[model samples]
Target: MNPSQNEVLTPSQLIFIVNGLLIGVGILILPNSLVKITQQDACISTAIGAVYPLYICLIITYISKKHPNHNILFLSKKYLGNFMGSIMNLLFLIPFIFIIFTVTPSITNILRIYSAEFLSPFKLIIIITGVCLYTAYNGINLIGEICKIIFYVSLPLIILPLFAVQKSSILNLLPVFGSGFNNILKGSIETLYSYTGLELVLLIYPYVNDKKKIKNSLLKGIFLTTLIYVWCVFITVYYFGLDLTSKSLWPVLSASEIIDIPIINSFRYLFMLSWTLILLRCITIYCFIAVYILKDFMKKTDTKKIYFFIYPILVFLSTFFTNEITRRNFLVKVTPIMVIFLVIYVSFIALLVRIKG
Candidate 1:
């Protein structure tokens, strides 16, 4: 359905949507990835790595502004012609579909390892995918509402990181910039996966009320996320040091354990609980984008049929990865390609649209 005026999202909702998608399971290992290469300068690396998502967001926003009434699917076919556009649609669709598979097992495993050992894998998969499907079937506006609710509610828990600073030694962050610009740059490249999900904006841009304000809204979202990432890295490095940060599987989670609040029996559990909400938001948004894209590509007015057919396959594919190594390998191998294709697809489509005009 074409978004009605009432369905249009405000800047705050847009920010919630973007930030929710951008911050997912990647945050857990981000400090380790940056510290492994840049050591104490991981924060600097995080700032630099943010440029990729920033640039991509600008490109998508620019394209959206030029075609405010149409979504990416319409723009692609209009500029690239049916055959090539259909090919591009399929290419873009792979990442959205694969994201469900990649994230489903990962989030489920995190719950199993850190929070809910009693929740069986089958139950976790069904509950997560089912909730996502039901949400997607309602439409993007509902997803935006869920995101707004989650974003505001999670503030208290997310701020728990501030308590971590008390346990950190400023000395641990000593000798900043010691990693050298080249090393920090290399580390920045490793953090690309953390910035992967902003492409969701391209699909949902038409739903945003103020098209002229998209660049401002997107930059705000990206900047906010950058602050969060740098804060996580700073606290983790300041507490754990480079050696320990590099060794920990999830430096942020380990760092959170240092917060000794009497009221909260375990800060780590609090972090995990809040993080599960964030991941659930991410998963739901991604599923909506996937079904939305397919529905548009197939020229269907409703997504109900597509949701039913696609989510079951998503459940089956998610189960294919039985262990952590396989999941890690799948992410490492697939993410770069998806990122590269996204860059090419957005740039090429934007260029074609400009030339034709």
Candidate 2:
């Protein structure tokens, strides 16, 4: 199975895929997390936080440009030697699996909280996991296509907060440098959880049709994601004020309650429904990466058998966290670990690749 025989991703599809990866269930809670630390300046914190992932994307793009048509797994093997590369690959795969556990449960928890409180987590996991497995087993091209569709479908919902802006108190953001830059910087840490999934580009760059466009696609995707994130934070802050936004579990969803559409009696439900798509898109990417890594490890071209075996374990693990607080704690505690691993792995590889050349 030559990589080229699989479908090639257009630059736009690449952008959507990265964007989908960046903006997941994180949006629902980001406002509260930032507000609690930064107060009225959460939007500022969001803008500052945006820089980190872009810098990461730039580094990834640099590496990918140096090794076009090769993914991180391949480069690690080539540059790090078989023994060391296999170790690095395992390091990468562990977090990829952890992502499935952390993100899948969080999304299911959100759906249960907002849409179906009566529904059990086990049932939700089964349904969501089934969909993710089906999508991932198809291959990168299908994931790219689904990501494009999810991106467009989610755009209007992402902007739905604009309708409530009139009700929002711009004055709520007074004393713009609230509690100084220190708190803003602290709040930026919260934003990292939101930006976690963009690292998918390390695997994605190889499958892109026009390698030259990778940089542009990555930049555009990050920019778009930052814009949406900032918008969400701004709307949540403006609509709820600092005190309410800080206290609220999910300021974005709570703020959506203000949107009253004649066609739909439940705008909040509609917003949550949109989130189902957004979250599913994110989960699918993580599951796909897991399958992708397993296939690479086994030297198997077809992932159907591998996916079947892995998907059930993913589903079972996803049900471990029974509540939102537990799910959030898992994300907060583990995100830094994954980020640290990614930084160390990429920096080490970059240094080695440079030294070797």
Candidate 3:
């Protein structure tokens, strides 16, 4: 494939993909975790913590806007030389895979726990790998269209709490800062992982047709996601309080479990349904980035053959670690370094783009 064959995604499609990328994986777990730290005032801590990532998005957008028709990978190669740029891309690629390995299984475990305990893990693994591979096999355009579909379906899942609000107490959010700034900041760092996927926009900026609008769209998408996250945090904290939410492994789902109604009487089922939608979207987008990063390294765009390579590698890597406890351990232990790496990675890209563009 050549430069002329490249297709830039429209700002709206990029926004759709960005929305999907921002909202998945951690949203279900992190809100509950924050309750442990934030206690009664978790909502304030969460909303305040959102600022740091939104700032990072803006900085990356600044860098992205400087390169009209290129992405971080291209800019890095231009300024840092082939070897170093490839290393940076690989750095991102590793974390991207780690994300896939960690998130898909967590989602699967949740599904098994609530939706279907009889579903075989191996069968579920194939289903996830197949969906990721299918998304990877298609080009970026199809990826965006899939995201568009995902965003609509997920809207309900993310917002389902609004329906069953009779028992919620805004007072559950009282006793502000009992945890202090340090613990709250700690929650922010932990929650930061949930919001980091918005920066995947940096990876896909090249596919956006108008570079100028990319920054605004990126921030807009992040803003909406962060807002939803804040609302969810409020709901969980208000409903469950800190002690209960902290003890629960899947806090978001736990909170959802309590929601009852004449309409459905089961929030867990709705939570699982929504979780799957975002999970599919998030995996597809990340795998696409991982495959393309490899393709850029190899100087090819024939995504079909590349998906063949990725699917097996991921399946094999995924098998080494089984059980939710092991997966959660890896995700928690490695995620901070992942965020640190991301901060540096964005700084590196911003600097390179400034130097070269």
Candidate 4:
């Protein structure tokens, strides 16, 4: 079914929604992760990684233009047939489900370590998931609104890292490309997981008010995301140097800790508070997309009822990885696989659309 008037989003809202998704938990630790592989050239790796999303945006734009009325769910079923299409749709849901599983735990762990050590994981999970459920249940229009607000509110936090520039050493990044072509490529691959949320555009394309602007919106969103990521990695490496950044679990957080405002004693705390909202937006978008896709399969059920079932399962699954190491390891291993599946899935779908047309 097509989106109602209430569900339609403007081009700017679409940009913010995509940005909100792309800039979540990944930003917290990306500097550390990239530094481990690309050393001082982590920023370059980040720029390289953005190409994946750029490519996806182009492919999705083509597919959406060809089939203006249908999202990926209906498109899959239309071209691939009931059995194979249903299977593909089910596989499509895996990444969103995986995101919910991995991101919920990761966000809780970050909050506990950085802001709310006093609270238990279950309590934090309840708070986070509660907000996510409420937002997701409201539908994509509300989620888009929330994302736009969060995007503007969190925009200032982007410059918080710039406060560290005065103390940063330019020498840390001097030997650029020292990581070699192979290592840079590997680091770029590592960043593919961070760029996962861009695919949500495929699902939401039908909801955009100006379908013709979707391609520009996607490019702008990816461009904004790449700039933020590159800035984070560049600033972290400049501030901490290669050795220290490689050791930091959340280097961006660590970098923020150094920002000394006149009134605020701990900028890190302020950063975490603001960042928690952005993270919530990310989870909420994922939850909404998952529920939206599921609605296609469960045509008779209400969305709220689906969320009731989904949230409980999410809370239960999030409890599996009790510590940071396990959660990080699980994401590290699984994300690459998810990335591969998404690449193949989008490419195959796009190819089918081309040939059939």
RMSD of 3: 2.3
Compose the digit string of candidate 1's lDDT tens values, residues 268-300. Answer: 887887778888888898888888778766664
**Span of 10 residues, lowest total lDDT, candidate 1:** 295-304
Ranking of all predicted structures according to lDDT, beginning with the best and ending with the worst: 4, 2, 1, 3
| TM-score ranking, best first | 4, 2, 1, 3
Comparing candidate 1 with candidate 4, which one achieves the higher lDDT? Answer: 4
Q: After superposition, which runs of candidate 2 have C-alpha atoms over 4 Å from their true positions?
A: 300-302
Candidate closer to the true structure by TM-score (higher is better), 2 or 4:
4
Alpha carbon deviation, residue 61, candidate 3 (Å): 2.2
User: Model 3 scores what on Cα lDDT?
Assistant: 0.76
Clashes of each: 0, 0, 1, 0
The residue ranges of model 1 lying beyond 4 angstroms of the native Cα positions read: 300-302
Q: Which candidate number has the best TM-score?
A: 4
Off by over 4 Å in 4: none
Query: Which lDDT values do the candidates have, in the order given?
Result: 0.81, 0.82, 0.76, 0.87
Model 2 has an lDDT value of 0.82
Task: TM-score each candidate.
Answer: 0.94, 0.95, 0.92, 0.97
Clashing pairs in 1: none
